[model samples]
Target: MAPPTSSVELATLGHRIRHQRLSAGMTLDELGARVGVAGSHLSLIENGKREPRLSLLQQIAEATGTDVTDLLSPEPPNRRAALEIELDAAQSSTVFRRLGLAPVRVTKGMTDETLETVLGLNRELQRREREAIATPEEARRANTELRLAMRRRNNYLPDIEALAEKQLRAAGHTTGALTHRTVSIMAEQLGFELIYVNDLPHSARSVTDIENGRIYLPPASIPGGHGLRSMALQAMAHRLLGHQPPTDYAEFLRQRLEINYYAACCLQPEHAAVAFLQQAKKERNLAVEDFRDAFGVTHEAAAMRMTNLLTEHLGIRLHFMRVSGSGAITRVYENDDLPLPADVTGSIEGQVACRRFLGRSAFEEQNRTTEHYQYTDTPAGTFWCSAQTGTTSDGEFSVTVGVPFDDARWFRGRETAKRVTSTCPDESCCRKPDSEALARWHGRAWPSARVHMQMFSPLPSGEFPGVDDSEVYAFLDRHAEQ
Candidate 1:
């Protein structure tokens, strides 16, 4: 009879059969005689190289004085067999295949000590591979450190702001909205020609060709009207800021944040943006949408820019958050002592916001056309918030800007009568279902979670964490020829 496709199960069965035969005090030849097979063929069966027929198995079991089930059990007969089985599995793994080495065949002559040594080496190899990968805990710790730094400075970076101001002045942009032409001129001032192409590397939003003094972007306009300009400016910011290739994920994150900040500063130049916001404050109409319109930027960008400038120039302590439809805090910045939901690692990015917080409640608002306002009483104090909903390819999100109740009078949404109380960080506030509902549904429901593969994956390999270097280089070569 033909053998079933070979696997660990067959190996385990062979070990059990060998063990039972020995326990019955029968030599291979003696067992084979009773089973009506050659000792060589019986040895092959005992070595997991052949499958025995059911009738043959019954005869072998009868000869060995054991049941057929005992001969087919999943467990190995002893410690030696278990080690051999584990070694076989390790050799069959992807990591073993990746080494481009021949599999080590286990033999009766191989000692247990040798098997243990080989297994130890394989385990160490796997440990090193895992160590090289960027773990979620490492990323969280890095983010926590960066967020603390941002909070210390009230989310403002004076040097980056000054650098942007110098470039904007050189581009001759001392006016209303920063035009695309001015962005182009800024690139020109840095000796970079703005070249749009459809074949830019998929991993990169824009690739700067330092050798050829060119910045390549997508031919199609980005979702937000100012995205092209922002990408171009951010690419130039890297060169202007004298950034080097990041050595680690933390450095990569810091570089990304700096470049984005530089772009925001350029988009909403300090002098003009501050003047518009001051006038809005004077009129007691400090609204994010009006700020967004005055600057021709996205709502999130306008709100984040407010975080940078409001505390430094306007004497206002505020908070900004971008929450997803599922209520996860995707982005946040604050110095208002507003108690935000965070994990033990002090990472807030993926934590769910309280259902009563404006960031989450805004999604339930009936009026989709206008901003939603609310006053939330929290452990820290009562705070007023203004949030507006926006949708992208990913899904809907809320961009919120808020302040303490004392400072709420300066904003347009303070008069809103809508209010709620949040006792979050205490899971009962939003995370935990009510007791009555839990009684009905506890242990009775199953959910298939939507897994985010990227969350489990290590940061992409290369000097730049997520950028494809080969693709980028090939793209540059293709465009450089033209």
Candidate 2:
């Protein structure tokens, strides 16, 4: 009754089976005869084309006179990420799928009763996530999927915008910031009550208590503070839009995207934003600051809106980055033809972004209060970018907006003549120029000790954001026993 192994792990097991059979000077036919399985099926299992059941594995082990543990042992990973990446690539590629293999979902004892137990446990886990009580791993996976989904959609949603705009126009707040009054008015207009609580935890942004027909928002989520207005509206959209609990990751993200779109629509009505963007695009003066000042929203909000406008409205594809103070790219979205650097997990988070990039360079300036601009040349194309640092209750982060050279004609910072060359993903050392260009500067640096500012350290696991993966995996494993 061993726990079911991952596809990659199963592959390793198959390799072990083949190795053991070879050492015994036995062909697949000989092993199949000994294990009471067809040689053709045994060959498939040996070549990692099939995942043998625990009983089959046990019988094979017995036939070979080898311990099951010997076959199940994993190779020493020099780096866990390398293996994860390989697995991800294999799972995505046609090579593995063509062999009649499927990616493993269950990670525990796979019996008939256990299968039902896993299904029940999965449903319960999903229910918890729907209520915003997801485990750390669940949250991270969902967040990753959601980010990828957003990227795939180019961070633009036309249908969602249409819905949001309709709701906004109906509420009588079609353009500009959806003030507290406007949100309240909308709630009243929709015949729903709004409740604000002082003691609500920060993480609990909003709760659409559908049963009570009231949308609850924390005092911190009040509309006036930067993105707070949209945050409040996001919660309201759930109830007003009549969205049910999402049953899967994609659905959850779509619903969330729609909710955020509804929020953004209230702040930047399509008509007004489009007119502004069209004027700026025509004038080639698309400054995010100009948009922020004109719209009275946060720089990040303005930058996010710019992507929507450019990609969906203006037909100018672009890319954006939300980088932490420590240089980790917390978020990235690109609709352009160029590829951005990403880690094996299809993530940019926790990976150091290039220092020459505006997102990272903003940190180098002593006063981060102003927007930093840069023009970068990559193999793909030239890009003009502007980034401004902003603080949150959590910590400070930089938001950047950039467009490809041809697309830059509509952007404000495009004319800034200064240029920086970036070989980024290939040439790792943007800290100085190339890895070879460092010369003696690496060891010759005699700067004063950097004062340790209070920075938000990652969770204790050093991998997940708020929840420990081991803790989550163990929790799920326990539930699997049910």
- Alpha carbon deviation, residue 290, candidate 1 (Å): 0.8
- Locate the minimum summed-lDDT window of 10 residues in model 1: 1-10
What local distance difference test score does each model get? 0.87, 0.69
Q: Candidate 1's error at 395, in angstroms?
A: 0.9
lDDT assessment of candidate 2: 0.69
Task: Estimate, for each residue in 1-482, the C-alpha lDDT of model 2 and write its tens digit.
Answer: 34336766656666778777877889899999988889999878865568888888888888888877887767522232224324444455433454476664533244445544534544464454444433434445556777777767767777768877777777787556567677777777766666665644443565554544566565654546665567677877877678875554446656776887777777877788989888987888888888888777777877888777777778888888899888888777777755466655465555678877888878777887777778888877888888888877778789998887877677766667778888777665454455554674778777897764423332222222233445445533543353
Error of 1 at 15 (Å): 65
lDDT of each residue in 246-271, candidate 1, tens digit only:
76667878998999999999989888
- Please, what is the TM-score per model? 0.72, 0.62
